[model samples]
Target: MPAVGFSPYTLYSREEWARLREDTPLTLTEADIENLSGVTERVSTDEVVDVYLPLSRLLNLYVEASQGLHGITEEFLRKGNGKIPFVIGLAGSVAAGKSTSARVLQALLARWPSHPNVALVPTDGFLFPNAVLEDRGLMTRKGFPESYDLPTLLNFLGDVKSGKARVEAPVYSHVVYDVLQGQTLAVEHPDIVIVEGLNVLQPAILPKDGETIPFVSDFFDFSIYIDAAEALVERWYVERFLRLRQTAFRDPAAYFHRYASLSEVEAREVALSLWRTINLINLHENILPTRQRADLILRKGAGHAVESVALRKL
Candidate 1:
C-alpha cells in the first residue's frame, strides 16, 4: 500500500468532493442522483456525486481489468472454458444510505463504457423469510449473522463464480417484509455483478470442527461500506420510517398499514422505539464491527453527506 501522504486513497469533505466533481473533466451525471441517493435534505452534498462518482469509475476500471483476466484464462483453457462474473460486495448499516449507493452504482456503472451489463444482487433475497425465521424461533434475531441462509448464499456466490449460465436467485420484498414466494431473478452472463447488504463483509459463523467453507466476502473482487455515526443513522432511520408511514403505509394494501393512521407524535415515537429496539441493537451487535473490514468506507457526517472516503490498504 502507498504511504498515507502519497496514497491515491482520499477522505474528503462533501464540499471538497463537490469541488473535485466540478474540477473533473469526465463528469458523468445520473438521473435524479439526489433522489436516487436518498439525499432527502435540500443540500448540494457531493457524497454521492463527488466521492461516489470516482468510486464508480474505479469499479468500472476493475470490471474491465477482470475482463482482461477472463480472456487470458479462457485462452489458456481453450474452447470449452467460460468466464465467471466479476462480483463486488457492498456493506453498511441500516440507514447509512448504502441501498441508495447500491442503486446509484448499479445504474452508473452499467452506463459506463467499460461494462454495460452489470448486475446488482442484494443479500436481502438470501435472508430467511420472515415466516421461516418465525418458524425457527429466530424472528427477533432477524438481521444478525445467523438469520441468513449461509450455505445457500455461499453456494450462490460459488455458482456465479463458476461461470454458470442463467443462474436464478430468489426475490425479496420489503413492502411485504418477506421473500416473495416462487419469484426468482435470473442473472445471465454479466461482466460485473454487485452484491449489497448489511452483513456481506461479515466473516463466517461456523463450528470450529467443520470443514471450512469460503464466506460470501471471499468472492468479493471489490467491496464498499457506507458508514455514519450511530446517532446519525438512528435519526435517519426514524426519519425514513416517518416518511414511509405517511406514504407507503397509508395505502390499505401496505403491510405496515397499522402505522399509517398514527399521529405525527405517535409515529415518531414508534419509529424511534423500533430503531432503539431492533435496528440500533443490530447495528451495534453485527454491523458496525464490520466497518473495519471494508475495502472502501464512505464515512458520512451529521447531515447525511459523506464527509470522507477511507480505503483500506490492500
Candidate 2:
C-alpha cells in the first residue's frame, strides 16, 4: 500500500506521454480506428498516435520483460515451463469509455510482433444470468460485485494463468441485457489477455481468519483504470443513452427497446435518474475506490480523449 499523503504514481501530461511513443510506429489506419471505436466514442487518429501508440510500446516492453523473466525461472528450474498468458485488468465507470480503451489496446497490442495473438475478454460475461438476478432481487444492483459469479470468474483467470491451452468464458449480450444461455467465448493460447470490466479492480474482502481468498485482480500482470470527473461521466452517460435511444434502443431485440419510444426530454430524465441512482452509487462505493489499485490510470478530458496518465513506480 502507498503511504498516506504520498502519491505512488508519477504523473505525465498528454504531451509528455506522447513523447514517450518515440520510435513507435503507428500501425492502425483511420478505417481500423473507426471499426475499433465504440458506438458513443469518437477515436480520432491523433488520439491513437499520441496516446495509444505510447501505451502499446510500454506494454510491449512489459510483455517482453515478463517473458524473459519466465524463461529465466524455467532455466533455473531445469524444466520445460510452459508460457502463461499475461493478463491485464481494465476498469472504470459505465460511461467512462473503458470499452473503447480496451478495444483500442487490443488492436494496438495485437500489432506488436512479439505478442500478436492477444485475447480480449470482457468480465461482463461472468455476470450472473438475469433469471438469477431477478430471483435474488438484485436486478437493481446488476453491475454490483454481488451480481457476478466470482468463483467462475476466478476459475477462468486461474486457468489462463496456469497456462491452460484453451479456456472458454461465458458470454453476455447487451442487446438482450443478459448473460446468453449456452453461449461462450473461447480464448486460445495467447501472449496476453485483456480483461475489461466495471469492477475488475475490486478487492476481495479479507476474512478475519488467515485463510486465503482470491480476487479478480490477483491474476493481473498489469491493470488500468479509465477515470474522469463525475460530472463529465454523467454527461457522457446521458449522451450515450440519447444515442442508444436513436439507434440500438430501436431494435426490437434490444432490452432497452422500450426506451426508444421515449421523448427526448423523457429519455434525458430517465438517463439522469439511472445515472444518479445506480451508476453513480456504484462508482462511488465500488469503482472509484479501486482506481488507486490500478498500475496505470488514464484520466480522460471532456471529449473522451486521454489528457494525462498516472503510472505507478516500480
Candidate 3:
C-alpha cells in the first residue's frame, strides 16, 4: 500500500489478503501450476492459496450479483431468460506474469459448482498475421494496438456476449510467430470467459466519421491489471529471452532460432536491445496508461510474487 492519501482503491497487503481466503478450498496441485505456467513465470500452490483463491471467491460474488441483475432485468422487461457469459479481462506487460494469473484464475473459477464452464482466451490470437503485418509495414510494431485485428476481435466478443452458442477465434503460434492458418479455437457457451492480453484495457479509438466504437474492456464484467516496476519487468524479459535461447529457440521451426547459437553476452545484449526498443515502449505508451481502467490491480514485487492488491472501491 502506498502511503499517500485519497486513493480510489483500498490496498491490502499479501497477509491481509490471504486471510480473506476463509473457507475457500484449494483444488489445484503443484503439477497443475507447473503445466499452466509460462517459461519464466511459475506459480506455487501457496501463492494460489493466498492470492488467487480469495480473488476467485470475490469473482464468484460478482458473477452471482450479475446473474441476479440479469434475471431481474429480464423479468421487468417481460422477456425470455437469456444467458450471457461473464467476461474477465486480464491485462499486463509481456513479462509481468499475466498469463500465469489468467491460467490460475481459469483453473480456480472452473472448480466452483455454480459456474463450471470457463474458457481462457489469449489476445495474442487476435494479432495480425506476420505477412499481413509486413504488408502493412507494421512488422516492427507488432503487439501495438494497431497491430491487432480489432474489428474481428470485437465481433467475436459481440457474438459471445449475445449468447451465441459457439464462436471461433484464430489460433496464434509463438514458435511460428504468426497466426496459424486453418486453425481456430472454438469457444462454446461458457459461464465465464477470461481474455488475457497486453492491451485488452486500451480505450476505443474515435473514428473521423464520428461513429462510436466499443473498446474491448467495454464488454468485460471485471478487469485486472498485473503491475510491477518497469526495471523488474525488463530484467524478467531479458532473463526469459536468455532461457528461451537454450530451450524453445533451439527448435529449427522457432522464429527466434537465430538467437539459439549466440553466446551469453551476445544474447543478453540482443534481449536488452529488444526490451529498450519494443516491449518497454509498448508498456509505457499503451499498456500502463490503461491501468486505471482495471477493476483490480495486482502489484508484483521482486521474483514475481504479488506483494499488494489494490481493488477499486464501490
Candidate lDDT (C-alpha), each = 0.78, 0.94, 0.93
Model 1 clashing residue pairs (backbone): none
Q: Any idea what lDDT model 3 has?
A: 0.93
Q: Candidate 1 residues 27-127, lDDT tens each? A: 33544565565634432334556766677766767787888888887888785556667798999888778777787777768777667778889888889
Candidate 3 lDDT, 120-221, residue by residue in tens: 999999999999999999987899999999999999999989889999999999887899999999999789999999999999878999888999999999
The global Cα lDDT (0 to 1) of model 1 is 0.78
* C-alpha positional error of residue 121 in candidate 2 after TM-score superposition, expressed in Å: 0.6
Stretches of candidate 2 above 4 Å error? 1-5
What C-alpha RMSD separates each model from the true structure?
3.8, 1.5, 2.4
Span of ten consecutive residues with least summed lDDT in model 3: 1-10
Highest TM-score against the true fold, candidate: 2
Order the candidate numbers by TM-score, best to worst: 2, 3, 1
| Order of models, best lDDT first | 2, 3, 1
| Candidate 3 Cα misplacement greater than 4 A, ranges | 1-5, 207-210
lDDT score of model 2? 0.94
